[model samples]
Target: MVPEAQLRDDGAGLAPASAGWFVLNARDARWFHRPGRGDSVPLTGCDELEAETYFPMLGMSIQVLPPGEPNATYHWETEQEDFLVLAGRALLVVEGQGRQLEQWDFVHCPPETRHAFVGVGDEPCVILAASSRQFQKDGPWGFYCADEIARRYNASAPEDTQDGDVAYGRFPPSRPTRYRDGLLPD
Candidate 1:
């Protein structure tokens, strides 16, 4: 990446006009947020989260994969994850394992638990995900998501609607980036 392409400000203290000369800017239409199939949840404004808290400050987003969809292909590192079933019903598959959940059910996944979320039931599956921190494999967050000990079950890019979460590259499908640098699963 060029110096200007990085998040850092240019030497002149302003963003370089040619920053995106190489990196393609995401399409405006693709930038919108539409959580579940029932309704579109577009953000009213741009947002950012600071990594600070008792447990690392987490960034969260809810996804509503209508019946027959799974989340992105991802796994955990030292970070654990918890999920709150907001609405509808679905099968939460952890690797080859599977479980049925309804609204209000709380599921806690320990660090590096091989898992994938597949939307099931007649209604849309709404879920809240919490992680330890923002994610990246080699970037600032240091999240090598693809190389995490856990591997993508291919459940991420569901070939059919009844399979899993559709590929919405908006955010990686890990849920809330919410753990501290030092947490161990109980």
Candidate 2:
């Protein structure tokens, strides 16, 4: 017998709680917002969803970044990560260099290649970001870089620490938010 698909509301938003396959509209997806930054829609399950489980092989999310805000601090992982610009414009800082990316631009970062993205242009930038979740013997291999260019965008770690609290100390924890209209381009 197949499991029935259902959406469960954990006081935040409706999220898939079934064991089988399901479909959900982006406009109705669960979202979270970080103060002073922007919002993110986790296509899979995020901690905010109260699923207590993450994708075993790969994790994917849609990042909605407002101008002058960054998706994350400059960092690199032990596994490959890829990103595709879906709308608007963004500035990509990779390996101590900066490049402007427009719609449909794709970026692939091999393991240990430091990179970060800052929303540019006049509107919010949308990005589809994915990363491998396979861990190594030493655990999730990753490091935050203290790049000068990243600092200008407020997207750099303070002292090259692996602790997320140190890297994102200035920002508040993300709060549960519902997907609102006009967050994505038509």
Candidate 3:
């Protein structure tokens, strides 16, 4: 069970109220929605954890992407990242190559490996992502995608894009989704 004080219900979503150790079932995890992106349930182990701080060593999350929706702009990170497909199907674009990913498929992305994913079937694709946050002094960097294939899903970087700042600006602020009652299976 999740403590009442640990979850802040601000109408948009449930966020951690403070920094500390906490436990909640996957179905009970807080889901945050990104307007143009999709929904993600961050498993940071603490509410006070920031994206820049690489304390937990492994940053994890469960993301749900609707068909044609891309998780994020095509980019690679300085740290290694791995992914496991939990449900549905998705198209994985890595290092300029595209691969069909099905349930139970696992993906390992080395450092500085460019990759992105898009839901392909009628149903939403669910993915479990884990990344090594160790030695992340400067975080990750976003890559510009000029490929026409990726552009079809709005996953490509804008023309003359300089960095992630330019790509992220195209999307709206993130909102929250109900993981327990919405996406998770009983």
Candidate 4:
């Protein structure tokens, strides 16, 4: 459980009654960015300061993608994942198909579903992502074909490369963001 000192009155730190459970409001959550991966604010129910083992059961995060920016490469995971569009608009690239998404749109991605997202329009697209944490025997993560749809938005992996082989050295390290106001829906 999170310590009393970390608890806040505005529902920023109200968590479940579990060993590592904790909470944080959108305004107070710390935001991070990975060079090519994009920006996100983790909404895990655990101490954010404790990076390694904060969330044990599932993983949750709010991803913010600017125009033409992508949340990640074209890939799928062994575990199921879901996404909710909170504000702005985006293009969902899944299984070589492209679908435009708007606020309140929910996407359900079953295991081994190839997918990625790219921000569209002038404003930033905010998405809430949730995924199962059940470990797999052959690893839960994998990258797939680089499609034309993903290439349009610069979200595709390098040509003729597999997962873990793509270089991210050109991208910037993930870091915290100061734009807390953007966390909320417009």
Best by lDDT: 2
Model 3 per-residue lDDT tens digits across residues 104-152: 9999999878788998898889999998777665543434555566677
Clashing residue pairs in candidate 4 are 1-19, 12-24, 12-25, 22-45, 33-174
**Candidate 2 residues 163-183, lDDT tens each?**
989999999999888878899
Worst 10 residues of 2 by lDDT: 47-56
List the candidates ranked by lDDT, beginning with the highest: 2, 3, 4, 1
Worst 10 residues of 1 by lDDT: 37-46
| TM-score for each of the candidates | 0.48, 0.91, 0.80, 0.77
Return the TM-score for candidate 3, rounded to 2 decimals: 0.80
- Per-candidate Cα lDDT values, in order, are 0.45, 0.85, 0.73, 0.71
lDDT of 1: 0.45
**What is the alpha-carbon lDDT of model 3 when measured against the actual structure?**
0.73
On TM-score, the leading prediction is 2
Q: Which segments of candidate 2 are over 4 A away from where they belong?
A: 1-5, 48-54, 136-138
RMSD per candidate (Å) reads: 13.7, 2.2, 3.9, 4.8
Which of the two candidates, 1 or 3, achieves a greater lDDT against the reference?
3
